[model samples]
Target: MKETPLCLTVGHLLPYSMTDFNTTDFTNPSTFILLGIPGLEAAHVWISIPFCTMYAIAILGNSTILFIVKKEPSLHGPMYYFLCMLAVTDLGLSTSMLPKMLSIFWFNSKEISFSACLTQMYFIHCFSVIQSGILVAMALDRYVAICHPLRYSTILTNPIVAKISLAVVLRGGMLALRYPILARQWPYCKTNIIPQPYCTHIAMVNLACADTRISSYYGLFVLFCVMGLDVIFITMSYIQILRVIFSLPTKDARLKTFWTCGSHLFVILAFYIPGLFISLLSRFGQNVLLHFHVLIANVYLLMPLVLNPIIYGVRTKQIRDRLFRLFTHEGA
Candidate 1:
């Protein structure tokens, strides 16, 4: 107030400005930068080692399952066919992130074009939804096999499994299609630097300059409608299966039925629990640390890919026996 120089006053206020001086028009930003694990940039090299190992295992393991299912005619049933679809989804999910993630972690190459980022987001979500559907399908298969053994073949024939697989892909693709389009239409006057390791619907939505409530609500709707329904159905199927198993006269029959579902139950729990956690955290736990969100999200994606094949290999006698025979024949 004492006749301070205009330049001096402006200089003093510059540091306090809340507006992003570099914020561009919504249409102006051609690219977004991914910051891998906000405060752990220095340790990216070490972090990438395990991620690379997981990616390798996911690819090799899933591919081996596909090969075994294809070459072994005895494995050509509905359950194995669904497992093959799961393998494909796992492959898509892992490949969608790992190459870009490794590049960011190892080379510090984080700049992604708007279109490419949206594409990655699409596949990531699509595969995720597809995985949920596959799990539900697997549960239905088990229910039929255990609860209605006489009609199992009639209920889930090869053609019917193929149809279910196609429907799963289509359903997931349709739901995922909207997310990227909504994000793309939003104006990004805020910073283009996404704090997470990869592009996700919520992560990209949070960066929008306009009100993001619609996108947020729609995402939640899709989660509940798709993944939530899958979980409910899977749970119901297992309950019925258990009821039927218990009704069996002999202990051996009941034990055999439970053993058959062991691998699938493990895979379902492994996939859904982390996914539900991530979904809840993204929506409600804004105060949670950024790295923790990143870690959990990565775990949701990587853990199933690595664990699914291992669980199936160890728990399913057919897969285990075939793997042993294949290895032994190779050695011979």
Candidate 2:
């Protein structure tokens, strides 16, 4: 069977198929229709219940963490300061996408304006990068506290923490700015249906009819430079932390030191493992199921946000005490 030519023009001799194909809208659409989890469309309502619940937990938990950290003078140290940064980043990360996702699932409102999609992409990736950097900062705080106990306070002072926070913000914003800029330059002559619920750099790039190699390469570059370096720095910091922990005099001392670092390590794993898995799956797992990819993507975005506050609250003794006292006092 020979394929019909998409555009054939010999005056009135042109076939109906060619005429229709040629007249088919090739211009960029002003808005995109997001098909939330392609194969699981019927289950979107059920899927949204958990997603909405996770978003609510993330918002409440992160907000509580921020409030407690702000009010507690005892938590004014570098570790708690970094925790506050993480809380804010988690809030931004979940808030960037969850509302639109819920709207898509519940009301079948999947249309997202072109500019709005780019903005969403920027915020989502920007906050994610900032969160990764903050995790590294937190790991460094632990390393200093454990490895250089006497100098910990001096090393990670308030001014230094502020500077690190500034650097994290600048790096995340600058790196993420390129995504929206590059995406905006691409002519989206293809279909405007983004497969995922949220707009991502690659997703927008994929909609372009032009050669997308540059965007693809750049996305990979940013991913490896930011997330890759972050993972390495975090790993090295924890390795040193572990070495110091093991070298401590007593078993109880070692346990205490490890316990202090345990929450951060769990948070780091929760943030990175699913993220890296999703990245790898998107890049290489072509044969993998589509619904699974969408599901993991949603999890990658929400799980750490929802779990971070819980993990820190339960694991950090001071936060637990503060929270308990706050609740009990309110009840009284």
Candidate 3:
């Protein structure tokens, strides 16, 4: 029988097999292998159990948030509108990455086409930026309600909210486009094994045989522009909110004002803390284990998705009451 080379391609878009590996020629692989948490391959099944559970709860919780907000006429305000955007963003973020991650863990299906991988990277990062923007909008909502209560409606009318939502989507989509575009241009002559389960900008850039300083700097620029500015705006709004609460001249009023902002504060911390950690670690954690980095990256993405709905559902009186009524068969 004639010998055949162990190589494959899908219209020139799949990875060449091991038989085609060449040390002398630098070329991009059409497929990349995802090593689901290197060094913890033996524990992948165990690790996936929690990840799968979180993804499931995220789906149910965010879905419930969307459904309840839509069905309740009282929740038709700007705050709830932003919350719906948040829930939708969370759903998108989780859906984009978790299914493939679970597949890698459960079925050992690690091969991902380069194009598919870049697309995944783009959506994951884009949704993350959108979620950040939504959080800022939520903070602004709380700020207006608490600080400028008389003009809250005037300032955040339905049209304004719609415009803000449009801006958020456009900003996230445009900013995140650079990642996959830059990644696509780089030559992936290095081994096509991505250390992380999902294709992150850093992970994909690491696989590039070319210089990546531009990508690295642009990532920092995004970090500053998105997370940094968002955090500053949220903090400033909350600071003003605090001033208003403290000047309310009654303990009950102050407490009530504080209570209203509690869920948003918690959600902000939940999203940003892990995110900042992951961002810093990705760029600077040379001493950290590969598996630890991978694990934390996955957690950073999943934690906000899982916790946002639970926080809002439990802390916001209307959401909590509606959720209770949902389970207990009470009136709308």
Segments of candidate 3 deviating more than 4 angstroms: 1-26, 279-286, 330-332
Cα RMSD, model 1: 8.5
lDDT of each: 0.80, 0.80, 0.81
Q: What is the number of backbone collisions in each predicted candidate, taken in the order shown?
A: 0, 0, 0
- The candidate scoring highest on TM-score is 2
True-structure RMSD, every candidate = 8.5, 8.1, 7.5
Best by lDDT: 3
Q: Estimated TM-score per prediction? A: 0.90, 0.91, 0.89
**Better by TM-score, candidate 2 or 1:** 2
Give a tens-digit lDDT track for model 1, residues 71-186.
Answer: 88999899999999999999999999999999999999999999999999999888988988999999999999998889999998888888999999999999889888898888
**Backbone steric clashes in candidate 1, count:** 0
Candidate 2 lDDT by residue in tens digits, 180-251:
898888887757777678888777665677787877677767767667888899989988988988899999
Clashes of 2: 0
